[model samples]
Target: MGKRKRNERIGALIKILSHQPNTVFTLNYFSEAFEAAKSSISEDIVIAKKMLEELHLGTIETIAGAAGGVKYVPLVTPERAGFFLEKVCKKLEDPQRIMPGGFIYMTDIISSPSMVETMGEILASQFLNQEIDYVITMETKGIPIALMTAKALNVPLVIVRKNSKVTEGSTVSINYLSGSSNRIQTMSLSRRALKEGAKVLIVDDFMKAGGTAKGMMDLINEFKGEVQGIGVLIATREPEDKVVEHYTPLLYLEEVDVKNRRIIIAPNPKITTKI
Candidate 1:
C-alpha cells in the first residue's frame, strides 16, 4: 500500500484505539500499518488523544518500555456522564414504567445497546485505576451492563448464576437472603471461573438492599479474589443502609408510588456534583 496521509493515519488510529479500549497496540504496529516511521505514528497518537479529550469522548494513553504501547481509555467526563445519567433518570421516571408491585420496568433502557454502552463506560471510569482483572455480576438482568463494563475495561466477565447448570462443570454454590423478597436464595459460580487473588469489579443493574451484591462478594471471597469496587445502575433511596456499604450507584430511585402512579428518580448527587 502507498503511504497514508496524516489525517488518514490519525483517523484510523483513533478508530482502532476506540474499538479496543484499554488494549495496548504498539507504535511499531501502527508504523507498519500506515507505512510511516514510529515518530509519525507517535505524533498521530498525540493528535488523536487531544481530539478525544477535547470532545469528552475518551483519551489515548501511551505506555513506555518494551511492553508499552498506546491504548484507549473510555473515561467519561463528569459533564457528559451527568447529562447522560439525567436523561436516563427522565426515561425511568415515566409513570408507565411503574409495575404492579412498585417496581420500575426498565427493560428497554438497560437493553438499549447505546445506552448500556455509555453506562458501561461511565461505570468503567470509576475504577479505571483499580487494575481490575475481571468484571463480575449476577446472571440475567445485570449481564448486559456487566458485559459492557468488562468490554470497556478490556477484562473478562464472570457471572454468578442463580442456580447451578449441568453445563457449568464443577460449581460452588452458596445460599443468601434476597434483599428484595427476604427469601433465602442460592447463587452459584463455576469453580474455574475466577482466579485466586484476582482483583474484580462488581457491576449490577439494580440494588434494593444489596443482598445480591453481598452474595457476589461472598462468592468472590471463596475464590480468594479481591473486590476492587461495586457499581450499580440504580439503588433505592429508602434502603439507605445496604448490605454492601461501599457501592457507587448511577441513579437513586427515590420512590415508586403505585397508587399515585408516580416514579421519582434522579442521577446520584455524588456523580452530578463532580460536574
Candidate 2:
C-alpha cells in the first residue's frame, strides 16, 4: 500500500484499540479487515504503541498464540495522578465544603465529567489485570465515576439502587444496617443485570465504615457474582473498623474538625494517590 494509505490504516487501528481498551483484537482480524499483510499490521501496531506510551495516553500489549492479539490499557501517570489528587484535596479544604452532619460537600467535584473521567482512568489502571466482568456502583453519587471506569475497562456498568424500581423488572433486594448512621436501609439490583459466576469490581465516591461496600458484596452474591476488587474516591478516618477490609481509596479524610474549620486529608501510601 502507499504511504498515505498505510498511515490511514495505522490511525484507524489506534482509534479501534483505544475505544476498546483491555479487549484483545486478533491480528488476523485487523489484517483481514484492512486487507493488508500481517507483517504490515504488526508494524503499524508497533508505531501506535510507541506513540501511545510517549504521549502518556495508554499502553498496548501484544498477546501471542492462536487466540492472542493486541489490547490497549488506559492509565494516568503517577505524576499527573498525584497533581490531580492534590488539587482535589485543596478544593476539599475550603471551609465552605463542610456541610451539616459532618459530611463534606463534594457534589460538584464528583459530578464534573472531566474530573470523574480522570479519576476513573486512574482507578481503572489499578484493576486492569483483575479480569473483571462488570463495574458496579450504587445508583446515585457513585454512578459518574463508575461509568467512566467501566468505559476505560471496556466492561458493562451495573448499578445497585437504593430501592427497587418498577422499571427494573424483577429485582433482588437486601436490607443492611448503615455503617455510618446505624440505620437500616435497603439496596436492590436487577436480577438480569449480571451473569452467574461473573467477576465484578465495586467503585464508590465515599466510604465510611464500608457498610455500603459490604452491602454491595452481599448484593453481588445474590446474583452469584464474585467481588474481584473495590475502589473508593475517599474514606473517612474514624471508621477504623470498616466492614470491607480490602479497598484502594484515592484519599483519606484523616481529620475533619468542624469547630476549627480544619480538614486534614492524605493520599493512600500504598498507591500514588498524592504527591
Candidate 3:
C-alpha cells in the first residue's frame, strides 16, 4: 500500500474518534493504524485534537501512564443538534404517514436502530453530568430508545409495563391521568427493578399528550426513585390545549397536512423542562 499523507492520517483519526465518542485511545493503537512510530503518531494526535477543538465539535482528552489513552468527546452544539433534528422531522411527513384521524404514523422512526442510536446519544450528552443511575421507559415502542440510552449512559434500564404477569415476579404499580386521554391508566414495574433513590433518566420514543411519560414519572416516584432527566425522540403538537411540566425532545412535527401533502418540521425549542 502507498504511504498515506498527513491529511489522510488526520481524517482517519477523526473518523475513529467520531464513531467511538468519549472512548480513550492509546498511542500504541494509533501507531499500529498508521504504521508509524509512536512519536510520529503522537505529533499527529496533537494536531488532530487541536483542529477538532477549534471546530467546537469534540474534546480530546489526554491520559498519562501505561493504561492511559486519548478520547474524543462529542459536544453537540444546540445549532448542530437543531440542524440534525430538523432533517429528521422532515422525514416524518411522508404521505404514507397519514393514518386514521390525520395522525402521522411514525412507527419506522421509533423502531429504526440508527435513528434511535443517534437520538439516544444526543440526549445522553445533555445528562452526562447528572447522577443517572438508571434509564426508564414504558413498554412497547419506547423500549429500544430506552435501552440505547441506557447503553450510552452505562446504566440499568427499568421498563414500565401496561399489565403485570405472575411470571414477571413482584412489581410495583401506579395510576395516573393519561395525557393522550384525560382518563386514568395504570402502569406497573417489576419489584427490585430499581434501587431506592436511584437517579433515573426517563426516555420514550414519542410524545403527544405526554400521558404515558407522566405515568412513568408517577411510577418512578412510587418506587421512591429520583428522576434526573426526561427525553423523547419526537414530540407532536398537542391536538388538545394542554402541556406537560418537564421534558426534552429531539424534534417536533408542528403540522402534517397530509391532505395537502405538506409538512412542518422544526427543531424543538430546548425544553425548559427539568425535574
Q: Among these predicted structures, which one has the highest TM-score?
A: 1
Residues 38-146 of candidate 3: C-alpha lDDT, one tens digit per residue? 8887888899888877776756777889889887766555666666676676687667778767677777887889887767777877887787888999888988888
The runs of at least 3 residues in candidate 3 whose Cα sits more than 4 Å from the true structure, single-residue gaps closed, are: 1-74, 239-243, 258-261, 271-275
Candidate structures ordered by TM-score, highest first: 1, 2, 3
User: Least lDDT summed over 10 consecutive residues: which range in candidate 2?
Assistant: 266-275
Q: Least accurate stretch of 10 residues (summed lDDT) in model 1?
A: 266-275
Clash number by candidate, in order: 0, 0, 1
Q: Write the per-residue lDDT of candidate 2 for residues 1-275, one digit (tens) a residue.
A: 23336788888888888888788999888888888889999999999889888988888899999889999888777766787888889998898888877788999999999999988998897887788999999979999999999999999999999989999999999998789889999999988899999999999999989999999999999888899999999988776988999998888999888998888887666567334
Better of 1 and 2 by lDDT: 1
> Measured by TM-score, how close is model 1 to the native structure?
0.98
In order of lDDT, best first, we have: 1, 2, 3
| Model 3 error, position 60 (Å) | 4.6
Q: Itemize residue pairs with steric clashes in candidate 3.
A: 179-211
User: By TM-score, how accurate is candidate 3?
Assistant: 0.74
lDDT score, residue 237, model 1? 93
Runs in model 1 lying further than 4 Å from the true structure: none
TM-score of 2: 0.91
After superposing candidate 2 on the true structure, give the runs of residues whose Cα lies further than 4 Å from its correct spot.
1-6, 32-35, 273-275
Q: Which pairs clash in the backbone of model 1?
A: none
